[model samples]
Target: MPIQLAHAATLPAHADSVFLLPAGTTQLPAQLADLHEASRKYVTEQLAADSKLITVNHYSHRHYFVVASAKGSAHLIAEAMRKSGHQLHALLKADKVTELYVEDLSESADGALALALAEGIYLSAYEFEGYKTDEKSKKPAALTRVLLTGAASAEAIQELDYLLQGVCLARDLINAPLNKLNATQFAERMAEAGDAAGYQTEIFDLPRIEALRMGGLLAVNLGSPEPPTFTIMEWKPENARNSQPYVLVGKGVVFDTGGLSLKPTPGSMDMMKCDMSGGAAVTGVLYALAKNKVPIHVIGLVPATDNRPGGMAYVPGDVLTMYSGLTVEVLNTDAEGRLILADALAFAKKYEPALVVDIATLTGSAARAIGKEGIVGMGTADEVQLLALKQAGNRVHERVVEFPLWDEYAEHIKSDIADINNLGKAEAGAISAGKFLERFTEGTPWIHLDIAGPAYLTAPDSYRGKGGTGTSVRLLYDFLKNQE
Candidate 1:
C-alpha cells in the first residue's frame, strides 16, 4: 500500500515517532525537547556508548524515537537515512504501529535532509503482494500514514511520492512472472501508465514493427508465440527545457530462455523474467517525469519480446539485417538484448535527440565484474552529459562505474560474415556489447548503461527491497530534474 503524506503543524498524539539526529549531539526539536527529556538522556547515553549508533527507542503509544547518525555529505546522509528508514519499517511492523511522525531534528534541517528522509521511509515501506496467496496472514509493514515536519514543502513531498510510485511501478513490472507480463501486455501497461501520468504513448504491434523493417526485433521474436511490441512514450510539456528531446532506449526482453543456446534449467533461466528490467526502468522514469510535470521534452523507446527456443528462432549462424539495414552475425542467440536494442537505437535517430541513453541488462560480464554494487556505463556522449549522469547516480546511491568505449574494443565485435557479431570475446564482454550498440547510434551522442548488476536484486539490500531494486528510475529522474 502507498503511504499517505501530510504536513503536520504539531506532532500528533499517538503516532509513532522518528527523529533525525546529527552525530555527536542529543539536541531535540523544540516540540520534542521538553516532552521527552528522559528519552533524550537515554539516546545521549547510547550515542556515547557507541560512536556509530543509529538506534531506535521504543516507548508507550507505539512510539519509536529513531536517532540516525547524520554526519556525512548530503548524498551519504541520504543513503544512511534510507537504510535507517528500512530499519524503522521493520520496527513499525513488528510493533504493529501504522502511523509515523517524522521530524528532522538534525542541526541541518534543510530541504535535502527532509526529502532524503521521506524518500527512504516511503520507498522502504513498499510491498508487492500481487501473487501472495497468504498476504493477509503474513501482514507486511503496517505503515499507512507518514506525517512530516520541518523538512520539505508539501509540493516537494508530493513530487517524492510520485517518484516513489514510479519506482514501485518499475519494481512491479520486473517482479511479475513471464506468464503474467508478456510483450504485448507490457506495452499495454505502458500505454495505461502514460495515460494516467499525462504523457503521449504509442505502441507498434508486430505488423507495424515489420512495416518499419525492424529486423533485429523481429528476428529475436521469431521464437516466441507472443508477438513483439515497440513502445514509444513521450512527455513534452509546452514550456519544455530542451529544444530537442532526450531519448531513452530500453531493452525489453520479457523472458530469455536463451533461444537455441539454451541456459541451464535451475541456474541461468530461473530469473529470466527480470530481463526486461531496463524497459521497466525507462517506463518508471517517464512516469516520474510526467507525473511531476517536469518541464522537459523526453522520449522513451522500448523494444519488447521474450526469447524462447521455439519455432523459427534465429540460429547462431544466422545473419540478420537490423532496422538500420546493417547485418549482424548471431554468434550466440543468448546475446539478444543488443540485437533488439540496436533496432531501437537506430529508430531513435528519427527524433534527432539532444542526448540518447540506452539501458539494458545486456551482459553477465557486467554483473560478474561489479557484483550488483553498481551499473556499468560506457558511451561516446559528451563529457558534460556523462558527468551529470555520474553525479545523478551518486546522488541517488545507484552509483555508476564508467568503462572505456574505445575503438580498440570495436575490433572484438567485428564480423567476418556481417557488419558485426552479436557476441564478443570473453574478455571485456560488457565493453564489446556497448560497442555493438554504438554502431546503431548514427553519430548521435549516446550512453549505454548495462544495468545487469543492479536492476534485479535476489536479496534485500537496505531500502532497495527484495526483488527488483528499480535501480535507474531515481538516477535518471535526478538527471532529468537537474537538466538546465
Candidate 2:
C-alpha cells in the first residue's frame, strides 16, 4: 500500500518528529525551539562537529535531526539528505514507529534538499515479500503515514510521490522471479502499469510481432517456449512541449541462460531474472510522467523474452535479419541484449523521435568497467544533450560516465558473413556494444544507457536494497523534467 503523505500547518505534538537542520547550526529552527536548552546545545555541537552523516537522534525526547551539511558538492549534499531519509525510515521501523512529522528547515534553494530527502524516505520504504509464505517472518511495511511541515512544497512532494511509485514499480517487476514474470507476464505488467498511470498500451503478441517482422526479437526467442512480445506504451498529452515524441527503448530479457552458450549457474545465470530491469524503468518513467501530467509526448518500447537452450537456439556463426533488414552475425548468444534492443531502436525510427534513449542491463563488460557506482553511457547525442543528462544524473546521484563512441569502435563489430556482428572485441565491450546499437539508430539523436552494474545488487546499499535497485528511473525523470 502507498504511504499516506499529508501536510500540517505547524508542528504536531503527538507524532514522532524528524527535523532537517542546516550545517554549522548555532540554533534550532522555530519548531525545535522548545527543545530543552541543554539538549539544543548538544545538538548544535553535533551539527558543528559535522561527524555524523545523517542524524543526531535524541532518543530520550523522540527527536531525530537530519543534517544538511555542505561538506561535499551540492549533489553529494542532496544525496546525503536522501541517504539520511533512508536512515529515517530504518530508524522508524526499528522502533515500530508508524507516524512521523517531518519539519524540513534546511532552507536549501527551491526546497531541493527537502525534496531529495523525501525521495530517500519514500523510496527506502519499498519491500518485496511476496514469496515469503510465513506471514510473521516477512518484513512488512511499517512507515505508513508521514506529515510534513517544511520548505518542500506540497506540489513537489506529490511529484516525488508519483515518481517513487514508478520507481518501486520497477523494483517489484525486477525482483519477481522468472516463474512468475516471463515474457508474456512482463507485457501484462507493463500494460497494467500503463492502465494505472494513464498511458496507452499496445502489446504485440508473437503473431503480430511476426507480422511486423521483428526478426531480431524473434531470433532471440527461437530457443524459449514462451513467445516474445513487443510492447509499446505511450503518453501524449494535448499540451506536449515537444513537436516530436521522445522514445525510450528498454531491453526486456526476462531471464537469460546465455542460450547455446550457457552460463554457469552459480553467478552468471543466478541473477538473470532481473534482466528486464531496463524495461521496468521505461515503464516506470512513463508512469511517473503521466501521473504527474508532465505534458511531454513520450513513447516507451519494450521487447521482452527469455533466452534458453531449448531446441533450435541460434548458435554462433549464424546470421540473422533484424527489424531494419540489417544482417547481424551471432558471435555469442550472451550478447543478445544488443540484438533485442537493436530491433527496438530500429522500430523507434518510425516515430521520427526527437531523442531516443535505450537503457538495458546489456553487458557484463559494462559491469566490470564501472562496478555499480554509475551507469555506462555512450551514444550519438551531441555534447549539449549529453551534458544535460549528466547534470541530471548528478542531481539524482545516479551518475553517468560517458564512453567514446568513436567511428573506430564500429570496426570491431564488422563481420565477414553479415553486415555486422553482435559481439565486439573483448576490450571496450561496453562502448562497442553502444556502437552496435548506434547502427540501429541511423542518426536520430540517441543515448545508450548500460545499467548492468547498478541495476541489481548483491548487498543492501543504502536505500537501494539487495535486489533490483531501480537504477535510472530517478535520473531519467530528472532529465526529462528539464527537457524543455
Candidate 3:
C-alpha cells in the first residue's frame, strides 16, 4: 500500500515516535513533556555515548526511538539521517506498526534533517507487488501513515511528497514486467502521468516514427511484435525561467534480449525489464516539476521499444541511418540503447536546448567499473554545468563519477562502413557508448548518464530497495529546481 505523510501540528501524548536529535543531546523540549518524561530518561540514562539509535517504551503501543544526528557536509548529514530513517522503517515493519510520527528535534539543520529522514522512510517502504497474488496479505501491514512535526513544514512536506511520488513512479514502471508494460504501454503510462501532472504528452506511433525517419528506434523494435513509440513530454509554464528548454532524452528499451547477438555478458539479461529506467526517471522528474509548478521549460523525449531476437530482428552487420542522417554500423546487436538514444538526442536538438541529458542503462562496463555504488556520468558539456550536476548527485546520494569523452576514445566507435560503430573494444565500453551518442548531439551541450550500476539492485539496498532504485530522479529534480 502507498504510504501517506502529513505535517502534524503537535505530537500526541503517547504514540510511536521517532525523535531526531544531535549526538550530544540529552534534554527534551518543553513541548515534548506532554508526550512523556520517559523520552528524556531514555536519552539521558539509557542511551550510551556511542549509541546511534535506541528505543524506549512508555506503554503499550507507545514506542519511541531516539536517533542521534550526524554532523558534517549536507551529503554526509543527509546520508546519516536517511540511514537512521531506514533503520526506523525496518524496525516498524518488523513490529508490524501501522503508522509512526517523525520529528526533527535536531535544532541544527533547519528542516534539512527532517526531509532526509522522511525520504529514507518513504523510499524504504517501496515494494514491487505487481505480480504477487497473496504476498501482501501474507505479510502484516507496513507503514501506512506518517505524521511529521518540528521543522518539516507543510510546504516542505508537500514538495518532498511530490518528489518521492516521482521516485516510486519510476520504480513501479521499472519493476513492471515487459508483458505488462511494453513500448506502447510505456508511452501510454508516460502520457497518463503527464495528464495527471499538468504536462503535455505527444506520442508518435510507427507510421509517424517512420515518417520522421527515426530509423534507430525502428531498427531496435523490428524484432518485437510491438511497434516503437516516440514520446514527447513538455512542462512549460507562463513564468518560465529560460527561452531554450532543458531537454532530457531517456533510452526506453523496455526489455533487452541482446537482439541477434544473444547472451554472454557481465550484467544479467534477466534484469532487462529495467532497461527503460532512464525513461521512467524522465517521466518521474517531469511529473514532480509540473506538480510543484517549477518555473522552467523542460522537454522529455523517450524513444521506446523492446530489443528482441525474434522474427526480423536487425543483424549485427546492418548499417542503419539515424534520425540525424548519420549511419551507425551495428557491431553488436546488444548495443541497441545507443541506437535508440541517438535518435532521441538528435530529436532533442529541435528544441534548441540549453542542455541535454540522456540517461540510460546502456553498458555493463559501467556496472563492472562501479558495481552499483554510483552512476557513470560523461558528457561534452562544460565544467560549470557538469559540476552543478555532480553537486546535485552528492546531495541525493546518487554519486556520479564523471568519465571522460576523450578524443582518443572516439576512435573506438569509428566505422569504415558508417559514421560510427555501436560497440567498441572490450576496454572502456561505457566511454565508447557515450562517445557514440555524442555524435548525434550536433554540438549542443549534452550529458550522458549510464545508470547500469544502480538502476536495479540484485539485493535490497537501504532506502533504495532491491530493484529499480529510481536512481537519477532526485538528482535531476534537485539540479533543475535550482536552475533559475
Candidate 4:
C-alpha cells in the first residue's frame, strides 16, 4: 500500500521524530530542542561526523529520533534525503514505530524535500511477498503513514504520491515471474491501469499484430507458446501543452531466454523476467502523469512478448521483415529487444510525435560500461531534448551517459543480405544497437535509453528494493513535468 501523507498542524505529541538538519550544524532545531540533552548531543555529534544518525530518545513515549543531514544543492539534498528516508524506515521497522513525523530544518531551497523524504521512506518499506508462503510470519515494516510539518505544498506532495504509486506498480510488474506476467497478461494489466488512471488503452493481440506486419514481435514470439501483444496507451488532457503528443516506446520482452541463442540458465538468464522493465517504466510514467492530470498529450507503445528457444524459433542468419518493411539480418537471437523496439518505433511514426523516446533493457555491454550507475543513452534527437532528459536524470539520480550515434556505428550493423543486421560488432555494442534502431526512426527526432544496468537490482539499495528498481519512471515523469 502507498504511504498516506498529510499536513500536520503541529507535531503530534507521541509521534516518532525525523529531523532534517543542515550539514555541519551543532545546534538542534527549536522543534527538537526538547529532546534529551544526551540524545541531542548524539545528533549533533553525528551531524558533525557527516553520517546518518538515528537514535532512541527517552522522551515520554520513548520516541525515536532520526537526524539526517540535508547538505549540498537541491539534487544532492534530495538524494541524501532518499537515503535517509530508507535509513529511517529501517530504524522504524526495527523499533516497530508506526507513525513518523518529519520536519525539514535544513533551510534549503528545495520545496520538495518532504516529498523526497516520503518517497524514500515509503518506497523502502515496500515488500513483494506475493509468492512467499511465510509472508504472514515475516511481518515487514509497519510504517503506514508519514506526517509532514514543513513548507511542502499539497500539490507537490500529491504529485510525488502518484509518482510513487506508479513506481511501485512498475516494481510489481517487473518482479513478477514469467508464469504470472506473460505478454497478454502484461497488456491486460496495462489496460486495467489505463482505465484506473484515466488514460485510454488499446491492446492488439496476435491477429492484429500480424495484420500490422510486426515481424520483429512475431519473430521474437516464435519460441513461446504465448502470443504477442501490442499495447497503446494515451493521455491527452484538454489543456495539454504540446501541439503534438510526445511518444514513448518500450521493449516488452516479458522473459528473454535469448531464443535460439539461449542464455545460460544459472548465469545470465536468472533475472530475465525483468527484461520488460522498460515497458513497465513507460506504463508507470503514463500512470503518474494521468493520475496527476499533468496537462501533457502523451502516448505510450509497448510491444510485448517472450523470447524462448521453442519450436520454429528464428535462428541467426534469418532475415525478418519488420513493421516498417525494413529487413533485418538476425546475427544474434538475443538481440531481440532491438527488433521489437524497432517495430514500435516505426509504429510511433504515425503519431508525428513532437519527440520520441524508446527505453529498453537492451544490452549487457551497456551494463558492463556503466555498472548499474546510469543509463546508456544515444539518439538522433535534438541536443536540447537530450539535455532535458539528462537534467531530469540528474534530478532523479537516474543519470544518463550519452553515447554518439555516429555514422561509423551504423556501419558496424551493415547487413550483407538484408537492410541491416540486428547485432553489431562486439565493440560499442550499445551504440550499434542504438544505430540499428535509429534507422527505424526514419529521421524522426528520437532518443534511445538502454537501461540494462539499473532496471533490476540483485540486492537492496537505499530506497530501491531488492528486485525491480523502477529506474526511468521518475526520470520521465520529472522530464514531462518540466516540459510543462
Candidates in descending lDDT order: 3, 2, 4, 1
Task: Give Cα-based local distance difference scores for all models.
Answer: 0.86, 0.88, 0.88, 0.87
Candidate 4, 1-484: lDDT as tens digits: 5677666757767667676666556666787767768877887776566555656655444444444444577788788878878877887887777778877666656446666777889889888756766756766558788877777766767778889889989999999999999999999999999999999999999999999999999999998899999999999999999998999998999999998888998979999999999999999999999999999999999999999998889999999999999999999999999999999999999999988999899999999999888999988888889999999999998999999987778789989999999998989999999999999997699999999999999988889879998889999999987885
**TM-score of model number 4:** 0.96
**Tens-place lDDT digits, model 3, residues 1-484:** 7788789988776678787766665555564665456566766565555576767666476555555554777688789888888888888887777878886677745577878888888999988777657854665667898888887688878888888999999999999999999999999999999999999999999999999899899999999999999999999999999989999998899999889999755566788999999999999999999998999999999999999999899999999999999999999899999999999999899889999999999999999999898999999889999999999999999999999888999899889999899999999999999999989996799999999999999899889989898999999999998897
**lDDT per residue, candidate 2, 174-282, as tens digits?**
9999999999999999999989989999999999999888878998999999999999999999999999999999999999999998999898899999999999999
Q: What C-alpha lDDT does candidate 2 achieve relative to the native structure?
A: 0.88
Which residue runs does candidate 2 get wrong by more than 4 Å? 41-61
Least accurate 10 contiguous residues by lDDT in model 4 = 59-68
Model 1: pairs clashing at backbone N, Cα or C within 3 Å: none
Q: After superposition, how far is residue 114 of candidate 2 from its true place, in Å?
A: 1.7
Please give the lDDT score at residue 183 for candidate 4: 95
Comparison by lDDT, 1 against 3, better one: 3
After superposition, candidate 1 runs with Cα above 4 Å error: 27-30, 36-40, 51-60, 68-72, 134-141
